[model samples]
Target chain A: MRNTQVIQVEGLTKKFGDFVAVDHISFEVEKGEIFGFLGANGAGKTTAMRMLTGLSKPSSGKGKVAGFDVLKESERIKERIGYMSQKFSLYEDLTVKENIRFYGGIYGLSKNQIRTKTSQILEELQLSEVGAKPVRSLPLGWKQRLAFAVSMVHEPEIVFLDEPTGGVDPNVRRQFWEAIYQASELGRTIFVTTHYMDEAEYCDRISIMVSGMIKALDSPDNLKKQF
Target chain B: MRRLRFLIQKEFIQIFRNKALLPMMTLLPIIQLIILSNAASNEVKDVRIAVVDHDQSEISRALSNKIMANDRFSLLAAPFNKKEALDLMQLDEVDIVLEVPPDFEKQLYRGEAPQLQTLVNAINGQQATVGSGYLNGIIATLNKEIRRNEPLFFSGLPKHNEPVVVTSNNWYNPELDYPHFMAPGILAELTALLTIVLTAMNTVREREIGTIEQINVTPIKKWEFILGKLVPFLCLGLVLLTVGLIASKLIFDIPIRGNIGLIFAYAVVNLICVLGFGLLISNFAETQQQAIFVAFFFVLIFVLMCGLFTPIDSMPKWAQYATIPNPLAHFISVSRKVLLKGSGLADIKMEFVYTFILALLFNAAAVWSYKKQE
Candidate 1:
């Protein structure tokens, strides 16, 4: 497999009328790399993430996500990447297995592929017992982990997780990180944004965005020495 | 196409998961459709009459024959005594009572006026007034015939002092069954209510639960998402509309005068106009409660101004003109003309054109309001 840049940006800026949400920011992530985006609250981390995910229009600058243009190629970007927002974005009304099947099916998976993935995910996540029950009945930690797994069901090139471990217990968060590393082993690039500084250690290289601009881009040891 | 099937499947599951909302969406509109259509009629058909004939002569029998033959009055019991006639009137079985006095023909032959006593139950003023007028008409004709034959008594009387009679024909609704007017209107109301409320609430609910954000980040196009949402409601609305028409036909006996296929086609076109209105409301409203209120506001305007309860011709010219833009009004008019009159496509071609344009306009507006990258 070619180890090339999966995400390349020159200067991506998003403005809301008089206010600038995401200033001209530039970065790149190699294939299968777990790149961490660290920022304080209101630091335009989300605006940058949205632009990269092709969910929001960039006011200026040019970028390519998963080899697709950020402008005029958003649909292609969506097909190539998986996204999980901070809101525990799963169908609470749907069962764990059903949620897996639905998300997979929406990515244009065939019936045979959906069936295979459903069983594989159930055993892998150890959610075989409650596959028929609704997601609303599950514990918060379990839901977050299941959400991560569902996001990656279609086996996209990259998984964009925005605060994926928010409000989960320490035990569950550790197990969740184990799965994140496991995903990287399968050559899925992980682009995550988090306020938890400790989570920054898991990245191959971390970029700290302050007020929509990248102030630091280096390994954790280097960043720690500077701070 | 496969993506849309999955998306629509998810929507159906979400809707059915809430046990209460599903039944409420399908049931309330149906109940309202049947009950309101039956209750909307105002034309009075059966007015019972009782005749007390003390003057059992040829004239009295002829008078009784004339009264009974008219469609307005039904003969209850022609009692010989006033007491018996009054008894039937008191029982609420009869609306009018006519009493011919004992000295009937003898007084008229002696060149003296013979009085006829008629009493009307004025409990419902409209029935009482109209009933009495009918009686007066029948008696006046008798009086004119009597005067013409007895020319000796009227030789001194002036001829110009005659009752200037006018005749009227019920051009459209001759039988005056109010159900005929309301069935079409009620069908219009149900389509708007079901389409707007269901679509609005579900759309907003998706936003509230954050599922919309998940779908937004997917490969689904904005127009694809909108179409996926609209197609399900369109299908469900059509099924519900068919059921509503069947019930109207079975319960109220509303005749289907226009093309049966045309009626369904008309409703589908109407759905095209209205389902987008719901989508537009959902796009603007951030919460399900806000969606409900916004939907209610627009649905109320559409239903009330559809001329369902009031006749469009009776409305002010400006308000009548406003109905031009109201989809519900066009629906009601189309249904009534087709169902009751069996009016062909040629007769209702203008309505079809206007509705088609309005539907296209509304759908375009709805699609325009949605932002994939705003």
Candidate 2:
């Protein structure tokens, strides 16, 4: 519970009826760090992520994300964070630029701010050529990149990406990782979940969950040596 | 306001661009308006009748001739036996059967009253009663003729007999033209259909496509998100109302005697109630198909209970009270009053208040049902 810790959880648990998706798990993600959350299918990675992102409430325990109380200040926490799902989530019917504008507007950016940031993001992602095209027409890799950029349009303090590169090719995945690195270099924290073990090496710190509990938390190299 | 404007723009583009939705949204309403209008007529015409003549006398033949001359009833075939008449009724070929009993002429001449048996199919009870009235009139005329020629002494006749003295004045719809009654109703129906589908589909579609979570994590307040989804459909509903009104005036020549402004105002209020219901359905449903099914069930019930097919006054006492909160009933009653009966706001003030209060109540329920988290 240092001031520098962006996300602090103590015995965070979620239960749907009698089933416990995420048991009493405790972890902290530091500011400006790429923290990888790894778990098997249905291993409570998503449930824990939902609670931390303020999308779902924990049945027991307490947590804080970005200096806001998870239960009472959920909306305030939402305003400071961005989220992207496993699916390349963007409005398929809207153009890339329109999607960015919509998300930026909802994040309370002024019209001028949206315009400026949209141009910059499009340029940074090398999407200037197809920015006017519908998101559905873009390749899966491009849509994922655009979604990531759209999530960060308001320049939130942190971004949560749940399996952000699920179905893309290896070359595209490499490029997507570069974008993540670029965001981290800009002093933004990245909370990412993935099943690909190799992707865990790219994170500064990694946590592996098994049966609703965090079994290991360390650098990929340290985790390998310990095992 | 700016966030809502952007969301509205996005929704409109999605609706306009979808290939399957464009035709369904635009063409379906027009086609339903034309077809249902024709089927909605209350004027009964071309009734079929089977005659069973047990007596081949001149009086029996004369009775058949009078029924045929009335222009309402069409004789199905030559006189059949009693068995044949019952067979035709069971086969659904004829709606009514006229049985002329044996010795009918002998009983009339012997100073005794003769009864002509009229057996009617009462499946559609209203039509059956009207048909029976027509048949009884023909037999009464035959009795008068028999009395006039013979000059028989009848001492105990009812005193309240006035010949040829029946007149009918149908209120609201003088001609009872189906289109005149149905066009306004269909317009109201279209509002409910379109608003429910659009609003309910708005959030659920986002959930399916994965954008809902992204938006949820943004700074957008819940009310802003909900309003963003609602305002576009409200505008579209108004546009549809205008198109329907123009079609009513130009194509069908449906009169609009009340204030046009008042009608438009009522339409706006009614849209709120429908859109609110749509939002509530969207919140409860986890998928697009579920939202659609839920909305369809409510719309079907609403249309049935709205007094479109049955008179509100004639409904059972409990059912009549239940329809008071159904916005469709209020809108239909107000539209019929304004367009057909030429009623002013003063005449339909109660209906207006009912619609307005229900709209607010439904919207409140919708806002309450929407959760800020999960």
Candidate 3:
């Protein structure tokens, strides 16, 4: 149960009927490290991330996240990890503060914790003025940032982001990387998937996948040199 | 439990915040109950009658007078013959044609039974059935009067051969108010429609917006999620039922004759049954539009077979058996039995058991079909 190896997987695989989405993939993510999964649009990055986050059942694999088995103890795994999906997943009709409070509450936060966390998120995201406004009114960049913050409200050991910077501008993507870095500094492992090369450069280690298999695994600079 | 509290709270906030849905869920159903109760009546009054008096005798005139004397029957025409009366009926001017045959008075005087034929328009089944029943009652009373006044004519027959008078009193609803019979069923129906549509649309909407992916990754259990969705809508259904009850009392003076708590007890189980059915439908649907169509499909079947407007006994045998599993049918039956007939728990324990079993089955299917991993 050491914190060093927060995520460890061996021969992880997922299949849809006869189609293999994620082939026999193996990897490990250390605490406080930013791990990036780089692949093309249909490269099984999302499928693999879904298995790790307990959002999908892997076809075959030995995997662990935050000291819990991915297949046998997914509920426990869910409790110890955070996931922000590829789509904008927050409630658009709810107020900014209400969204934060709701996610925090579902994650078993105390009332006082939600109270303080609401204010902290508003202040940190500079959303205090629009705290009462519905999230549908927020800009895309602001909404993505708030989604990331809400995902980490439970302070889990690992946060999984699936193409978290898919459609935002470069300026907002840079701000999003800053949020990732801040989370890594807080000793939360960052497991993110993206095809953006610049975003990949921010990860401590990167795995580039082709089809369903990881073609290369190395530091971004080493990957650049090898390629 | 606390997680469930948060889920329910968030649901309520979203439900109330949606301007279009709020009024539709609350105000619209109440208005429907008020307006529909008055408009959807089965009371057969002012039946248009056309008499064809061929005999032109004293008894034929007496019969026509007796038919018209009742408040329910209205005289439309006094045709000279049966063909003229049939013409009036064909023109859609009258609902019934009472014919007095040529030997009508002569047959009675000769101690033979005279034929009195009545032709009824069978369109609008309820109006036809009840109007015919009223006509029969009036004729029976007239026959009894004739027999009593002309006892000497019946002296040849034995005492036991005389007509046996059967008196029928309608219990619970002495006056046979259509709204009194209809309000409780309408209340159950509207509550059911609201719960089913809302519950069916809820999860599909989350899936449509991709929020389900986020929820699937959370630590919340599947039962907790389903229960969370059900609880809020269950409360709304109960609130609607209460509102309907009050409106029925205020507007229709419908009696709440049974134990009031028992009504709510049955309502909770029935509403849960409806909610589970809705969730099961949502699990099969991938989008809100699909959910709505699927929900509407089932709701239509539920309402038509629920024995609300039509008697279940009159349904085709197979269709009547289909209502065995229909929770709405059972709910409306229990509603009328308890609210109108003053039925106690022992009297309706069978309905309670069946509704409870349906609830469990629907909820189990809903929970099983709602796969987080898939």
Candidate 4:
């Protein structure tokens, strides 16, 4: 599984009437790879990521995530991956512990499994004290971290994060990246999209998009010298 | 099924957490039932009358006394002539003018039918029409009495030439209690309003806040998500109906004449149809405002034609046919029939079957239109 590619897509594209959001982009992410998708706003990076995560259909191309076809087997793809959107996606009215348990339950975890994972997530994120408080009471930085943790509660083969640290400060972004690294070390492939160049520098490999097409795909260090 | 349970639990927690929602569910329906049933009534009462009695004979006095006998009419003034009575009506002091012509009893004594003129302020059409109908009933009764007692005036006629008497007995709601009639109809309306608006708003709110994007990436099935939404609001609508029923019984003394289970059965189908219609609206609307506007438009039409305040039979033929698809109208009819008329299942089977079909169709549309991925 380590040597195998978890995501394989060829000529994947998405169009909205007269506009092409994602155009014939081809890429493959190996197992345990922290693949960074970076581009300016409206450059189709998010659109491409949506296709991989089974949140949107590819217009006229074939793609597979975790060996499941994105077009036909999206439901199967959904069960094998976790997705965190650009917006904070947890229920703000629910307490931290309830949010975790809810995601765990929805992901097909047994009751005992959800209970154990709830405690484990609370302990790991150091959110045990605030677990009883509503997510609204927590600061912005804490909410984002909890969202990522909840997304990963089922321990999927891949976790797709779309600007998971959009509004947070530098220090919080560092801590959030640490969580991604920890998830990667646990053998979960992290397919993340971010606007921060510094965040792209941390990824094992990065793909830069320009006008709905990937312009460069390589190790960040090699791409830094090439640019 | 496990996923659906968690979704339902999460929805309930959110609904209760919103500060305005609990009162909207509990206190609002009770308040609406009490105020609407009491205020929105068709039975005209306390009509003010001014009598212009130029012929102050025994028969004229008896007619005036008989009009004032019932609690429906009260004497505002006994003016000297029709002009003074007209002046009272002009000042809005009296709603009606009862004119008694000169030689009123003499006309009866001579066996000549004399015309009795009455002027009514037609501004408030319901009050004018129903009030005049009441006056006509009283005058007819007095006319019958005179013919019976004064048989000597009709000596040339046969003994069997007496005027025929007609009596009316109101069925279902005897005494014509408007509140009793209104309570069940309003209950149906509130149930429909709550289920539709709440379901539509909550679904759009999820999309507006982007929780739906998170939900889309999950393994939860489409039917599971829909059931998650439908089940909680369905239960809430039922709870609302129960609260309204209890309140109507306590305040209006509305009798639950039929089997309680039959009412609930119709209510369950009605609510599910309403909720599905709401969800279908939500699918077309991208924002909470859009959902509410669309829901309000349909609800206004539904309530107006649902025969809650006005009888559906009175609506024009096309409008009456249009109300056939209105779930609120059907529910109101079924509710009134079962709750007030003591109607059994066989009596309301048509309404029940139509609503059940709408439930299936609307829910299918809601599911078909709700997309996990674009």
Candidate 5:
């Protein structure tokens, strides 16, 4: 189990010109685990996620994702992992299938792989009927699901979801979690950040961060008992 | 390389998918090239002249007739005095007032160099300069007629009166067809404007929409990313150049003396240079509005100094030196030389070298300033 660690952080810190966004923190996540990074507003969840996803550099600390140093080998880290931003970053003007093909292509996926997976993903998401429509025409829940599906089109080793379930109906959030659990079951690591305590309850393990430092790290039942 | 192709494909799709920007990009150059090119020329034509024929002599009439005979000037009125002529000029009714002094014919008969008073509205300094040149041309032609018509029998001077006629062949643009020169220059301008505005705004839009964050997380290299943004716009730029060339050839009758293939080749280098500069500005701008303002700031300065409207020779030494690295300046010089003058690559080797160097520097700056994060 120790050898199965997919992410390892030791004293990871980040600074933005005198503002400590992510203070010294340490954590680990094993393979095939749903690890929830819980934090309140301005708790540095996003800043931490940015550093882990290679979209930002950590300041004065050590961080690793998928056995690659966060600072030095960000390019390699990018190739091996997936990231779905909270902003719904997929192109709304592009059709659902086009958006899928675009992401898959950028990840160096072949035409055949893209074509075959396009139908598979659309069918699985029950979005086959609307796959040819522009993503802008879809409801927020559908767009959110489609964005997540596009992020994983390249079959990354680990998929980092930054507040993936933000601002969605409870039912949709539940459905989104089901997809996360399914990905975890397939031995793909999931590193998700969320503000919902209930979502944290569904994680295999949870680490609560406050003021750039981790205050708790345990399973849901253990944390509840300790609290 | 494969990832680069994909990124380029994504960019092309996004660009073509943009309903608002696509129409503007396609229409602006067409309208500006067709409408503005004709309006952007320096050749002085159709000057209204108010002639004050005080002498009312054959020589004064011959001079007025010569000014009118040359299709460049029109005599609106033959005023009795210079005051009415001056009034006409002040009212903007005439561009020049030609007052033939009373001794105009008598002075020539007496072998004295009589003064022909000429007043020109020098409001538009270039217009005034050209108008004055035309005035000098009329006077010189009359002087030649006087020299030839003067009888050698008077024995006023020696046989050295053989007229030293300065036959100026306005070569290349013999008729001084302002349109022929303006068409290609405007095309160069259209290319520069379209590529700059498109590349700058497109990159910044991605940042505004937060798509840049998603792209930054990709495994794509920085050079690949910048090239991805540039290649689509470059292809579109080529399309624009071709259309402009065709329009210039068909509508304006602009001669294509140089090799069309050579034109395309240099346009590639020129497009790369302009696009690279645009991308460099985009890399520094944090928002789409900022990108537009900054891009316009540089584009305005570069285009204005590129000799599109003003002659390069007329610019001061410092301004000419400043235009040395301006890619639009290089492109305009190359396009005009190639299209109008039939100049080959050998003739424009220096321009190509400068553009190539500018392309290298601008692309390098664009890549360097592009922060992969934040």
Candidate 6:
């Protein structure tokens, strides 16, 4: 895995009318790095992720994500990045394989590519038996794992997981981390947001946001030493 | 284009997996087409009535027979007095009353005109008018017979000349079968109703479920996303339209005089407008229920103002102006022109233009509402 800047943010600011959700924050994520974004509820981590993912416009400032201009080439950036929302954003009515195929297809994967990727994803998660079952029928742990896998189906250069393991068991979270590590090994940048302090340890680097501003950003051990 | 195919595939999978919505998407239009087509007829028939006969003479019996023979009147009871007849009318058991005077046939032979009275329930004025005309026709026939051989009496009767005659040339619907006229309009209405509800609900559902955010993050363009959601419902609308057409033909035997292709062409344009309205509603609504409610309310108003049930000329000028963009109005006119009047495209160019422009305006509004970033 190469260490190159895949995402660069400079004074990115987002305001919703009067309230500032992400206030003039700046950051950069190197390729194949597990960049953990830590924040409390409403600390603007989701808002910032939204801007980086092109889901929301930055009120001001500038950024480039995956070598695409954030302002002018947001559509281009969108095509190359994957997003897994905090809400376990798989279609509940669709089967696991269907969700994978749908996301892969939307990312411009051909049928053969989706079929092959789906099988590989199912094999990796040991969820081959439930691939044909509806996502709604699966347990929360399985859903989180499936959502993570579905987000990477198109081999996007970067994957954004918003609190991806919100309500899963510890064993499932450990397994989910293994999948993220595997994605990093495959040269894909992993930008994850989580409230779990323990999950921050798995990242290559971590940023803690407080009240729409980054209070600390460094390796976990370095942050603990500073504290 | 690839993203669009994927989005459409996702929608189809979701629709197929959601067992409840699938049946409703396909079946509701057909069921409504069948039921509303029957219930929406304008022909007034089987009106209930009561007869108060005090004469008990052959003339009174003859009048009663004529009334009974008419398909429009159904005699509920023979009331003995005026009070009893009024009581039946008040109870809603009878819609009309035929009152016979106590004078026997001797009055007529004595060269005195016996009086007959018809009391009608006028709450529904159109039905009352039709009932009155039917009763008057029967009385005129009876009067002609009463003076059949009395040239002296007829000559002295102030020359009862029936002048200032009016004729109705019911061009399209000579028989005036209500189902035949209503079926086509109802089918057109189904296109509007189903297309709006399905497209609106589908888009709002995506927003609520957060799949829209996922898709937005993909390389998919805005047009791709919109078209992905739209094309499936358009196909569904066409399928429903075909089913409605089959129902009209097989069950009601409604005629198809003009080109079937032209009807479908108009339907496609009309679906674009309906779906555009749905997309606009989805963009404004925050929840699925809100989207459904708003769409339903607007569709109700559009249908009422479409001139399907009432004459557009009778509506106020302001109300007529409000219906200018209503696709149903144009579709209804086009439908009747084609199905009943056997009119070609040349005959309905204005209607076609109205529908086409309305479709374009709605689509432009929808595209404008779909924001790329929020």
lDDT of 4 by residue, A26-89 (tens): 9999999999999888899889989888788889899889989999999999999999999889
Residue-level lDDT tens digits of model 2 in B163-265: 6756689887777778999888877887678878878987788778767877776667677777877787888888777877887787788889888888888
Q: Is candidate 3 or candidate 5 better by lDDT?
A: 3
- Whichever of 1 and 6 has more DockQ, that candidate is 6
Residue B362 of model 6 has an lDDT of: 78
For model 2, the docking class works out as medium
Error of 1 at B306 (Å): 1.6
Candidate 3, residues A1-227: lDDT per residue as tens digits? 35589889999998888998899999888888899999999999999999998888988979999999999999899898899999999999999999998999899999999999999999999999999999999999999999999999988889999999989999999999999998889889999999998889999999998889999999999988987
Which of candidates 5 and 6 is the stronger one according to TM-score? 5
Better of 2 and 3 by lDDT: 3
Model 5: runs farther than 4 Å from truth? Answer: B20-26, B52-58, B65-70, B76-93, B146-163
Error of 2 at A119 (Å): 0.7
Give one digit per residue, the lDDT tens place, for model 5 in B165-260: 676788898888888878898899889888998899888988888888888888878998999988999998998888778877888889999988
Q: Write the per-residue lDDT of candidate 3 for residues B1-374, one digit (tens) a residue.
A: 89998999999999889888767777888799888888888888789999888898898889889887899999999988778888888899999988888989999878777778878999867778899999998888887788899988877766775667687899999988888988899999999998899889888999999998888899988898999999999988988888888888989999999998999999999999999999999989998999999899989999999999889999999999999899999999999999999999999999999999999999999999988886
Worst-scoring 10-residue span by lDDT in model 1 chain B: B37-46
Better of 2 and 3 by TM-score: 2
Lowest lDDT sum, 10 consecutive residues, model 1 chain A, at: A1-10
Reference contact recovery of candidate 4: 0.87
Model 1: residues >4 Å from true position, as ranges?
A: A1-3, B38-166, B169-173
For all candidates, state DockQ relative to the true structure: 0.61, 0.75, 0.79, 0.82, 0.69, 0.72
The list of candidate 6 runs beyond 4 A from truth reads A1-4, A67-69, A110-116, A127-134, B50-65, B75-88, B97-119, B147-149, B157-160, B164-171
lDDT score of residue B183 within candidate 5: 83
- Candidate 1, residue A186: the lDDT equals 98
Q: What pairs collide in candidate 3?
A: none
The most accurate candidate by TM-score is 2
Chain B TM-score, candidate 2?
0.90
Candidate 4 to truth, TM: 0.94
Which residue pairs clash in candidate 4? none
Question: Model 3, residue B345: displacement in angstroms?
Answer: 2.8
Q: Which ten residues in a row have the lowest lDDT in candidate 6 chain B?
A: B156-165
lDDT of each: 0.85, 0.84, 0.91, 0.91, 0.88, 0.85
* By DockQ: ranked, best first: 4, 3, 2, 6, 5, 1
Evaluate model 5 with DockQ and give the value: 0.69
Model 1 agreement with the true structure over B247-341: per-residue lDDT tens digits: 78877787786799988888888887888888988999999899999888878887788888878898899999999888888888888888888
Q: Write the per-residue lDDT of candidate 6 for residues B262-328, one digit (tens) a residue.
A: 8888888888878888998998988999998999899888899998888788899999988888888
